[model samples]
Target: MGDSIIGGPRIYSCYKCRNHVALHDDIVSKAFQHVCSGKKEDRQMMTGLHMVADVHCADCREVLGWKYEKAYEESQKYKEGKFVLEKYKIVKENW
Candidate 1:
């Protein structure tokens, strides 16, 4: 957890520790969580209504944030299959 990749793609790490927390990339890829996801439910976000699943860290089991499972509004469709990490809990790793 302490070792940093010499020339790795820049990622986000937990501010509280050197734990691999999240990835900050332009590509909107579906997060493959072999670990786990909380129950899927619809919630009204600032942007719009969305069905999201709470994502958990496999290593430390912390509440990383959520995955956008489904977007109800057409304008918010792009957010589907993306993640939302807590801004206050993460820091750029290699940037």
Candidate 2:
């Protein structure tokens, strides 16, 4: 596995409810326990594909981002097993 350091440890909080959901470095491209809702196909502006679902803050129920339920591309299969964090929907707190 190739892991790139985006940054140091940071707390990711929901933009709407300010509820902490995940850590910066811990996020992947797949579903995480307690961090994502059930799979739903939706058209994403970023990916321009219909294979994502909303991730939410378990406590506040704020929409964070989408996880790949079905990968649009074969190379994106790795993303099928992780959760993609939306930069606009979350706030990062450095510790």
lDDT of each: 0.71, 0.66
User: Which stretches of model 2 miss by more than 4 angstroms?
Assistant: 1-9, 28-34, 42-50
Query: Can you write out model 1's per-residue Cα lDDT over 1-95, one digit (the tens) per residue?
Result: 32345667667765555576545553255644333578999999999899999876666667778889999999999898888777775668776
Candidate 2 pairs with clashing backbones: 28-83, 29-82, 29-83, 30-81, 30-82, 30-83
RMSD (Å) of each candidate, 1 decimal = 4.5, 4.9
For candidate 1, report its TM-score.
0.70
- Tell me the tens digit of each residue's lDDT in model 2 across 1-95: 22344555567788887777776556652324446575687566455454777887887777777666677766656666467777899887764
Model 1 lDDT on a 0 to 1 scale: 0.71
Q: Clashes per prediction? A: 0, 6
Candidate 1 error regions (>4 Å): 1-8, 23-35
User: Candidate 2 has what TM-score?
Assistant: 0.66
Highest lDDT among the candidates is held by which one?
1
